[model samples]
Every structure is written in C-alpha cells, then in structure tokens.
Target: MTQKSSVRQMIGFITDVTRWSLSGGIGYQLFLCLLVVFMMLGVFAYLVQWKLGLAVTHMSDIVSWGFYIANFTFLVGVAAAAVMLILPSYIFKDKDFHHVVIIGEVVAIGALVMSMTFVFVDLGRPLQGWHIIPIIGLFNWPSSLLTWDILVLNVYLVLNLSIPAYILYCHYNQVEPDPRKYRPFVFISIFWAFGIHLITAFLYEGLPARPFWNNPLMGPRFLASAFAAGPALITVLLVIIHNTTVFKIPKQTFNKLRLIIVISAIINLIMLFSEVFKEFYFPTHHSLSAEYLYFGLDGHNSLVPWIWTAISINIIGTLLLAFNPGKNKPMLLLPACILLFVGIWIEKGIGLIVPGLVPSPLGEVVSYAPSWVEISIALGILALGMFVVTMLLKPALIIEHRFKAEKPS
Candidate 1:
C-alpha cells in the first residue's frame, strides 16, 4: 500500500481499540458482539436482496418506496442535525460548541454512511448502482431526484468527513489548525449540510403522483424534523458517550444541547400542525392523505391508530424537552429521546411510505409487510450503524481526552 494509505489504515486500526475493548468487556461487549453478528446477518440478507431481486422484500408496484427509502430519508435528517453544533460553532464563533464540533461531524458521517448504504440496498437492479457515474456510465444527470440525492449526499459526506478528520488530525498531532487553511471548506460544510437534507426532501416533494409527499411544506417540514431529531440524537449520543466512559459533559455543553433541542423541537412541532391545517383548509382529494394520517380516511388502516399515538408521543416529548428544559434529568431525557425518535421514524418511514401507497392515485390500496428476513436486515443495518459509531468515535474520543489534558482547557 502507499504510505499515505498505510497511515490512514493505522489510524483506523488504532480506532479499533474500542472494538477490541467491546469484544473483551463484560457488560457492553454483549452489544458490541450483537452489533457485529447483526451486521453480518444484514450483509447476508442484502446478498439475498441482490441475488434474488426486490421481491425478497414486501415492496410492490403500488408501494415502490418502502423501508429502505424511508431509512435513507430519516438518516439525512439525522445527518443534517449536526449543523446545530457545527455551524453555530464555526460560523457564529461559539467556542463552547467548538468543543464538540468533531463529535457532531462524526455523527453526520455515520448518518451519511447509513444513508448511502440504504441507497445500495434499495435499488431494484443492484448492479446498476454504477449507472449514475458521469463519464464512465449512463448518467441521469438531469431528471431523477435519486440522482440529485446521490450527488448531494456524497459531496456533503466528503466535506463533512474531511473537515472533522482534518481537525482531529491537527488535534492528535499537536499542531495548530491553520484556520485560513480550512475556512473555505468550513463555509462549504454549512451549505452542504443544508443541501443534503433539502435535496432529500425535494426528492419526495418533487413526485407528483404521491400527493402525500407533494406538499411544498414537505421540504421545510423535513428540515424542521431533521433539526429536532438530529439534535435529540446528538444529545443522546453525548449522554451515551458520557455514561460509557470516564468522560463527563459539563453543564455548559448540556445547556447548549437543551437550547437546541427546545428551538428545533418547537419548530418541528409547529411544522406538523401547519401540515395538518394546510390539508384541512384546502380539503382536496389530496386532503385524504392528511385525513389518512390523523383520522383514517377509510376503513383502510393499521397506521392511523399508531400514527395518532406517535403524534401524541411526539408532541408530548417535544413539549417536555422544549418547554421543561429544567427537567433534563436522565429519566425525562431518555423517554423524550425515545419518543422523538419513534415519532420521526414513524412519520418519515411508515407515515410517508404507507399513506402514499394507500388510496393510490389510481385508486388502489396496498399494504407492505416486511418479512422476517427483511426486518432482520433492517435491524442489522441499525446495529451496523451503532457498531460503526462505537468503532469510529471511541478512539477519537480517547484522542480528544488526551488533547484536553495536554491543552489548556
């Protein structure tokens, strides 16, 4: 291997120390092992998806978009949330957020990886994954939103990963980061993060047949939900990192998290309400989708009940996190996190996919039931995400710890 490649691998190998610890530890090792086993299983199932076709999953002509697309979109939302920390720190000169910008970028990287992985799994003709390459392949450069998503997500990923990795390298090497050296790239990160999620939302909103997805507000709603879910995810991740190691987050960091959570949560909740009102006020055949969401337009339903519960849980969670920031005690924070995740997952995953399938534009009603294999595969992807986060962030955290000790904190 080239010397540069060797050095990168060595850095990665050092990062694997946490994997080694997780493999050896008594309590947490269980999760580590499970993450591995699940990932392997997921990979096997993906092979099945590739070998067979999309048939292994429950997708149909009516339900062209299923869990994978949903996962992709949700991950974009998760990835975009990192801007809460990254932009405010770099652009606004918030030194407090500077402390965790690396962490935030790493989280964005993790989410981006999962989002792209979902793209690989979602394609019907898996081998056609390469068709989008420009000079070497048949490029759908103009028409498809999938194409745009592919471009934006990947570009954003490189920018996000580069910024953090470069910063961390400076941290590890005990060298000053030439602020001038990275400023242009940092400016790009601010726009790239927004672009990634906006393109994802546009991918759906641009679709005309899917009235459920055809709202102008869909894009902003996505950003709002992303803002909420992303920060909440980061907060949980911060707490997890704190609890899992000797590291501790001070009150100041927690305060920033609380503020971001509140602002984002309020925006997200308001967006949901506006969505409901937009449907009710105009009351078109299009209104049926929102009706489907809130009050079950027809006898056709397994989602409305759970969706109502999800909305309730989401609203309550948002209220608790946003309004009662004082009660960020672990118990409150934990449930609030669970509720926000579930709510957004349902809204984006089930809510988006299922309703679009229902009372179809052609007036067909079809439902998707993912098989054991498919469900396993999806769980495996999530496990893979968790495993990757553990592997990538652990060594970085250790390095950060050493940096904090050596530098004037």
Candidate 2:
C-alpha cells in the first residue's frame, strides 16, 4: 500500500470504530450511559480537587500515597498481563490463542490508559505532569525509576494499539497481514510487557525506608499475581463475549487459560506465604509494617481485617480452581475467576500500598482512608476504561468475524 492510501485506510478504520461504538443495543447503550454518568461525576470531583488541592483527599505527609497509587500499581500489572496471552500465541504459535490475542491487546490498552490516569490524578498539581514528558518536561532519566516507568508504559501502550490496528486494518481490507511488518513489534511487546511491571515494582522495592516493599521477590510476586489475575479477568470477559455476541471461543482456549491461571495463582500464594513467614518469624524492626498490616501497631489496626479477608478469599478461589468442581461449568468457573480477580485487587492495592507507609520511618502511626473525592475520581477512571474497552471491542469483533467468514476453507 502507498503511504497516502495507508493514511486513508487508517482514517476509515477509526470512522468504523466510532460508528460501531455508538450503535449498540438498548442494554449496551444503557451501560454506556451509566458509565458516562460516573465519568461526569468523576470529572466534577476532580475539578473540586483541582481547585481545593490534595487536602481534599486523606493523603498527608505521613501517608503520602493513597487510593490513587494503589490502583495505579494494580492496573500496571493488569497491563503487563497481556504478555501472558501474547507470548503463548506468538512464540509458541498457538493458533487458538491467535484468534483472541487482539482481545488481550485491547484490554492492555484500556488498562495502560487507566494506569497513566491514576498517576496523573495522584499528583497534587496535575499540570506539573508536563515535567515528566521527555522534551517538554524535566524527566530525570537513567537514575529515576519513575522516568523508566514512564518510558516503558508509553512504549508498551503504542505497541499494543498499533499491532492490533495493523491486523484489524488488514482484515478490514480483506487482505492477509504481513507478518514481517508486525512480528518484530509483537516480540518487542512481550519483553516490554515484563519491563513495565518490573519497573513499577522497582519503584516500591527501591525504597529502603519502606521495608514492606523492599523484598527482592517483589518483582516476581508482582508478575505472578498479574498473570493469575489478568487471565482470570480475560476468562470472565471471554465468557461474556461468547454469550452476548455472535463470536464463539474455542473450549481449548478456556482450558489453556485456566491452566495458566491455576499455575500463577499457586505461585502467588506460595510467595505470599514466604513473605508472611519471613516477616512474622524473625520479628525485626523491619517487620513493623507487616505487623501493622496483619495485627495492630500501637493500637492502630485499620488494615488488619482487609488483609485477612483478602487472604481468605484468595485461598478459596485458588482451591476452587484447583479442584475443578464444576467441570468446566461457567457457574463455578466464573465465580472462581471473579474471586481471584477481586482478591488480588485487594491484596495488591490497599493490602500492599497502605501498609508500606502505615508506621512511618520515624515510628509514628497514621491511618489512611480515601475521601469521597478520591473514590469518585477512581470510579470515573474505571468507568472510562470499561467504556474504552467496550467501544474498541465492537469493531475488533466485527473485523474478526468478517475475516473468519472470508478465510478460504
């Protein structure tokens, strides 16, 4: 294709995506409306915060990071989890996985967007975010993990969006995608996926003052939980897609994804156990954060109940997956996946972020709870992500269906 023709084709592709997003059934439209309402509320709340300042939220010098950073941490893992699907489909050449890989890419794009948004909102002055940009801002490079994180995340987002767009454009044109053109990007994304999450983990582990996040296993634990939670989410989404739309997913695909989820969940649980044992058995000054999380520190035990509940739910979910009691039944499988996803969200979000800063380095204890403003903004960001995913998926599904129909039998 000539350069001019390629540009024209890309414009047509975007036009189709917009049309499909806006033209859906009553249920889909209602869902979109609900998301829009929340988005509006979030925008209102953000504006209030912007005018009033971070003081409107509960974060203080004692607990510098709060609700926003927690979500950012979890979403980064979710974004990285796309590699689970991509690696298997491309490197291993799993044909069944190839059909669904684009779906994973769409999810990654939504997640990365959310992750970046959270980072933006966490800033007291959102406008200062320009400083993080490479040329326009003073992005401290090489030495700064935040700069590294910003680099990897933006690159991964572009890769995910472009690769899927290339394939879908080819399908729209009723032509085969050139592997030579896109395959290199695919391989780069697999490694870049790991880099984004690992760098995010480094952001925590690099902090020596916060012993709770300083473990060497932090990166591996992040990866394990991400692989488990990410696929669990995708599994639930696949079921919804199969039921609601004309597209059909293969049974083997579910089986393969389930296997990946189970293995990763087990590893995540084992790592959790190891970390707990190390913290409780030795009982050093460094273990204070863990103690604050699980028990109470100086009678301030806000996180105790949440952590235990997350652990219990995670155990139940993992067992449910291991036993296979439902025998591939959606009734059983869906709940298990939901449980795993929610449990990990809690474990990684509040369970991880809050404790690291609970008992301040100076031995002061400060409790943190998100204000209504923070909650509203987070809901808005999450709704926006769902909205994006829903819109993107419509055009992707249409293209996939058409491609399958036109393929030579």
Q: What would the per-residue lDDT of candidate 1 be over residues 1-409, giving only the tens digit for each residue?
A: 5999869966764565545435545667777877889888998998887788888888788777777877888999999888889888888988778777777888888888887888777777767767678888877877988788888888888888777667767767666688997889998878888888888888878989888888788888888888878888888888887788866766577677877877877887888888887789879887776677667755766677778887888888887877666566776786787788788878877787667766777877654667766777887888877776776676677667777889874
TM-score each candidate: 0.92, 0.98
Tens-place lDDT per residue, model 2, 1-409, is: 7999989988888898789878989998999999999999999999999999999999999889999999999999999998989999988999878879888888999999999999998987777777778889787998999899989999999999999988998999899999999999999999999999999999999998899999999999999999999999999999999899999999888888889999999999999999999999989999999999999788888888888888998999989988889986889999999999999999999889998997888889978889999999999999999988998998899989989999997
What stretches of model 2 exceed 4 Å from their correct place?
1-8
The clash number for model 2 is: 0
Task: Supply the global lDDT for candidate 2.
Answer: 0.92
Please state the error at residue 220 of candidate 1 in Å. Answer: 0.8
Q: Stretches of candidate 1 above 4 Å error?
A: 1-24
